[model samples]
Target: MPDTAGLAVRTLTPDAPAEAPPVLLVHGFGSDGAGDWIDTGVAAALTAAGRTVIIPDLRGHGASPAPESAAEATAPALAADLLAAADAAGAATFDIAGYSLGARVAWAVAAAAPDRVERSVLGGLSPVEPFTAVDIEALHRAVREGAQCPDPFTAAIAGMVSAHGDRAPGLALCVEGLRDTPFAGGAWDAKVLPVFVVGENDELTRGIDGLAGSLGARLVTVPGAHHEVLGGPHFRDTVLDVLAR
Candidate 1:
């Protein structure tokens, strides 16, 4: 596919006639499109069901170029990149399934371009922005100076970032950008109704019920933790069923 907005997209064509609008699968933080969806068989399942799948490596992740500054990695910016990917894929409107940080970006996209999104499945998401509580200085120190984070949450995030190896700096910038534009589910005014899915054991999504109620949407809880849910068959099946409707 053509490179628009500097995002590297993996487009999968179905074996049979297309059964639905192009499905965009957005991966979570520190994970690329292939790692989150392709390797997990989510994209394959959707494609086998005759849906054109578009997976984009968000800025600062995978093969996509990292953002020069945190400003370039904001939700709106990432949403714009996804839109550009859709345009390149020849999809005027599409269904979206996003996990974790990707879910937040899906929210921004639906809010900004409601007419372009046919439906959305937000997995591993919450009304509360986890980045807001992140200690930015401590995170930066941990990434740059190999210092330990004092805060438990920050330490957790630092560990996730470190797992990405040299991508730690870019991911850290993304964290800062996300913190700057914290998610407020009450403020969401998208016309499209989204199905919210959270892992039953996910403490990070404590306020998901309130967020789903505010949107007049259904919340489906699967058996797993935050990261585990994304790779589970339950989460994949839930997304496929929701988008099929």
Candidate 2:
């Protein structure tokens, strides 16, 4: 275990090489790598395929220390931390996969250093940025008013964030940090091997195909909604297929 710019990271190496590049798994907002990857069986599957797995608890989540300043919580900054995790894992170049918010950071990583990414799977992502219009102040008010907020999802997340105790404010700053972090069609141009996976019923489906085409990446549609997509067999199979290629 080591720190990547204040982020906590864990690496799981396979007993044998399946000829696959080491893989990095980045989790979504409010969630950590273990909760998103390991608990979902993604990490185990990758290891079963003989690929080493690098899982980092992004700053402000899990065991990682939260960023006291919004500047330290930007997506690009998080992307840089991923590279640090790669260095810790002794991987100069590696395969990568990320879900939701992590996918945004992954795009930044590949955009900044395409040569270091052998292949990348962007899951639960779309061309439209999700946090751009999120009303952080309203969400904060809802949290303070209790869990009986108007948006159930927001309330649930507020609960999770607040459960971390004093880390809530930092998490709020993180939300603000990512608010303007663009994943718009032209914001990132990654030439690395990239793919997109989304739930067929996901609202995030808009512009995903176009974004994938722009990157010359394949788009895989799996059954289920946004959060449920990662648990589907289609997602698992698609990830393995892409990595195998």
Candidate 3:
């Protein structure tokens, strides 16, 4: 559906009334709402079980609009785009699940407007102390050059997950976010949420566990590398587990 970001959102909803509330699946950078995660069967299985699913292409990724100015690519800005989608699509409220960069943006969205989101699952990232100029410059560089990892260590970490097709756009968006956080100006006091999923083998995601725990969120560890879990069979069940409640 059309939204503030002019982004296309993919959805899977049952023809019959759904048993669970809608769940929005946000894929990491370089991937679209569908290719990044929904196509993995996560969204489909949930909808099959009588749940409504919403998947959005964050701005600058996939079919979503890419901002000319750097300011438009931050997580907070992306969150605003989501709100526009919610309004344009007439969504009263819904659960959100974000993976990697999308997960970070989901955090901003739910944190900024807790009531607007029924429940939230941030799949790949943890909250960090406020960003610095170095972070901003790094984001700018990464956004401009899609594959530049700061160090061999980070590069190796990323290379392991690069086999997944959606990583490209994710890298680009990460650059943008690092250069300037969409929610930099806003403060989100991570409210309570039902659950958070982290990849057992992913060090990056493990860091996010600390963030989830601080929010008093439930944690479920899925087996596999970061990208694998996003594309894994159990992902759908883990995602729906939050809504199954």
Candidate 4:
């Protein structure tokens, strides 16, 4: 484990000659690197295939320290942290694989360091910002007071945050930070076209087709819901195949 600034990163070295550029695996909201990538064997599989794998526990998630304010936890700030992690790994350029909120962060990373990102696989990403629709005040109230969130969407998000136990407050702050810097897919300017992967049953990414087309990116529909997609062999194989190309 190497600490880059405040981020705790887990690096996996390949057993043989490196077949591809270093890959950064960004995890989703309410979940850390281990829970999303490591536990599902994606990290090990990538390593076995001769790729150096870099996994960062994003700020306020896993071993990384929580941000004191929403400003500090913004997507751009997280993107900067990831670039620093790549720098620490000595990777001048790399590939990226991110899921859900991680996908949004990956978009930020690609935009910030367009020249450094060789390719990207964005999973479960929505055409519009998901958090912009969330009721932030209600979310905070739920986290702080154990009150029920009024909106069904906010309630669902609240449930996910609650699953993390004591980290609910920090996660709530992260959501606020993300909501502050919402995703606008059409505004993306990165030259490197990404491969967008979504589950057929994932309502979150329902309108991603339009965005993907505008970006001239490829879209691959996999076989599960948003949460189940990452852990499935379809996702792993799709990512592996894409990166190998």
Q: What lDDT would each prediction earn against the true structure?
A: 0.90, 0.80, 0.65, 0.89
**Runs in model 1 with CA error above 4 Å?**
187-191
Regions of candidate 4 where Cα sits further than 4 Å from its true position: 1-3
Task: Score residue 84 of candidate 2 by CA lDDT.
Answer: 88
lDDT of 1 at 218: 91
TM-score of 2: 0.87
Q: Provide backbone clash counts, one per model.
A: 0, 0, 7, 0
- Model 2, range 1-245, lDDT digits (tens) per residue? 54467678888988877866799999988889888999888888999889999999988888888887777788888888889888888888889899988888888888777878888888998677666665667656655555355665566656766776677777777777777575655644444657889998899767788877876677888899998988778888888888874
Candidate 4 structure quality by residue, lDDT tens digits, 51-93: 9999999989999888888887799988999998999998889
- Write candidate 1's Cα lDDT for 1-245 as tens digits: 37579989999999894657999999998989999999999999998889999999999999998888889888998899999999999998899999999999999888788888887899999778889999999998999988999999999999999888888999999999999988888655555689999999998889899878876799999999997999899999998899884
> What stretches of model 3 exceed 4 Å from their correct place?
127-174, 182-194
Q: Candidate 3 lDDT, tens digit per residue, 1-245?
A: 35545877776668765645577777776567878666687877777778777777877677776665556666677788887776666677777888877777787778667777876766766445223223444443443455576765445434533443454435444454544653222333434464767778876654555555565667888888877878876666777776675
State the weakest 10-residue window (summed lDDT) of model 1.
184-193
